[model samples]
Target: MSQKGGKFTKEYEGKKTGRFTRNNEDRKNTRFTRSNEDRRSERFTKNNEDRKSERFTKNNEDRKSERFIKGHEGNEVNETRPVREDIVEGRNAVIETLKSDRTIEQIFVAKGNMEGSINKILGMAKDKGIVIKEVDRKKLDFLSETGAHQGVVAMITPFKYSSVEDILGLASEREEAPFIIILDELEDPHNLGSIIRTAELCGVHGVIIPKRRNVGVTSTVYKSSAGAVEHMKIAKVTNINIIIDKLKEQGVWVYGADIDGEEYCYNTNFGGPCALVIGSEGKGMSKLTKEKCDKLVKIPMVGKINSLNASVAGGIMMYEVLKSRIDKKMQ
Candidate 1:
């Protein structure tokens, strides 16, 4: 491309002539000359291959110096953000977290106490694509969010969980029907806790919960589930109704647990591409969410109370679904 120029009132119709603006025009022409993609191509693909590589490496050395090798040779420096507030306390929680997807800034595995749990933690960290730094127990304590860094603490990027599509695709790869549980705005930390434990126990494929107005994994929630969170793929979605619709489109039945429903959970065939939707604490399933449900089933309360505790209700539903799958398998 030819140099771009300014308009002038003089001859040649397109000739640019000016005093101070000449410098500006010259500057624009220089920028265009430098901006040509052909120059970059030439630099990258020189007649001399070795020279091309050397030039490329030289130009990119600034980005290179800052990289920490988490096994890959030239992987991008893991663009980590601030440490999340969740990991500063429990030793086991820190170890389990290190096994997951969150990127680590630096790990402070306590100075001593380096045998059973500590060694395993180090091994897992190496396997799971993170850098580690051994430091004094005080350092771990200082970084502790709960002052319980347990001689092992890690500063990590915000936790990144799997997407609904990824989890569903994973389940579909297996031969049997994929069972998924959708939690609709469940608030109690303990409720979130037990649901994950029960879901994993029942071999339901994965768990999907809303990103907003829902319970998320915390220490209390994790403890309540008794370490089931590690085994489950928990996905957060912005629109539970839309996700339900999508699941239905994919031939997955969306069943909501409701008191005034046409069917009971167990009587319905759970041995299919199915997802059971459990409702929130106070109001139950949102009306819009309930409408998106393919079918609403109830868990028949035999007692004086109209409703079961949220976690208890979810566990019952999950077990019923699992029982149906097992029965189908036996047949």
Candidate 2:
């Protein structure tokens, strides 16, 4: 193109052209896109932080629940102490328990079912003065683990049997003349417990019971003994006669309680180290057990009831023996 002066001159423009303009535009576009990318990155970072915070909070809550549940095993959720349930049910089970020297916590019987074996149980319970509660059959059913509770259930303490040596050691530790009571094949835990309680009160040294064919200490016996089991030394032996022989060798005179005795209980000398043997509930004394006794004494009964309850008779005999010892000590 020609200039204003009609002279042949090169035309030049001051405005920027092609490549540089395009470069400037590209730079601006890159800046804008970078700004957008930065904003998106901030948003994504914020979102990730929020998710992490949520996960942390959830994890804390789960940990707390785990701790709470872990703290209570086989125990109440709110209870501070752990507790265990020991439930024994059934007629013969309960009966045999009562017969054995066991610590019974409580007895539950079905209401309105007090005949037959249940009656026998009640009689045994009464003789031992065990705590009995008559409840609905459903209660027994709920308490029954075996599902064969013949209208009765007993809550007993865990049994802890002692050796004969333990009893002798207790006597030796006391430094007093050993005054022991022996139960031969006595079945009722209540009777045994009652005897133990009375013996404790009377300051007896220890009590010996046969392990077989006899009630070893049970919860019912412990309860019936009125917690005297804690104070008294009880020894369980395989054979009652062997223990008797051992006692005799230790210079302890053994006396047997029988219906046919050579002398009355009052007349029998209960001085020095002596052991009194009480028989089972139904049978008085076994032939072998009777032979083990150094002497036989009887409790004079004037009542029409030919046989006395084992516990009652044993209690009477225990008092007599204790009284005889006291009288001799005084003299």
Candidate 3:
């Protein structure tokens, strides 16, 4: 490891046990220990322990240096993107949002309104893993879009609804049967949002809702979906019956949710190209829309309540269909 010069290279000197480093000015004329070959060989055996110590120290420092320098310099050049905000105001709106599967950025509660609705909103936000911020009434007023803060407000990302074609295309691309959810004039944002969230979790391709006589995608639905609306593909159409006809032509069998239907939800075979039509919160499916259904399915209830929450009913039917498909796949 010796260099072909007057002075020995740093590499050779490093191998020596205790050689003092020479200054640059004196390096050209530095002297070495006598009998260099014999001294080097003698020191080699004794230097084993020191060599291990030096190697460990050098390797550790190199690894530490590599962490911040190697394979990470390119990442440092990229800028961090900012998140978009969708503000939902009012106590009820904020509460319903926290209950949905939506990702809430933060909740601003007006000071001194934490008694009833505001208190419930705060609890729901905390339960849903949302960030809550306490602010003055003026702050709530400033963040409010509807001008009716009702002592609570929330900031969330906007909902993105998809197209019916995209939903069917997704099912086609996956080479699996299309499992779709169609809402027939649903009037409640909470129910729509909850149904969207449930559909997303249950592996449905997409959801379809009529553009009119339905509670359109709103902040309340976004929140009620607990944020699952973001991952779901929801399409708005002018007429759900037309869409049903189209889906049927594409080999999708339509199942309508009714209080008095021919097939019980649990007993029905929901294993192929299928669409489940959920009716409005107040009125079930419209007469024409119900007539468009290939088969009518009902939730069997022994309890006193004849009907369930629209979201709950949709969720039950969705899972039933999902279970049937999954069991078919297993077979």
Tens digits of per-residue lDDT, candidate 2, 1-331, equal 3455343222222233545677788998998899889999999999999999989889988886665455422223324322223555666557766787877778999999988889998899999989999998867655543345678888887656577677777778877778888888888766887888789888887788876788665544544665576567777777888778888889989888899989998887776788889889998899998988899989898988878888888788888878887887798
TM-score, per-candidate, Cα-based:
0.61, 0.54, 0.58
Candidate 1 per-residue C-alpha lDDT over 198-276 given as tens digits, one digit per residue, 9 for 90 to 100: 8888897889989898867655454556557767888889998889888888899999889888898879888878898
Over 4 Å off, model 3: 1-138, 141-160
Better of 1 and 3 by TM-score: 1
lDDT of 3 by residue, 168-230 (tens): 999989898999999887876668878988898899999898877877666556556654665
Instruction: Please report, in order, the local distance difference test score of every candidate based on alpha carbons.
Output: 0.73, 0.75, 0.77
Q: TM-score for model 2?
A: 0.54
Q: How many clashing pairs in candidate 2?
A: 18
What residue runs in model 1 are displaced by over 4 Å at the alpha carbon? 1-92, 98-102, 107-119, 122-153, 217-227
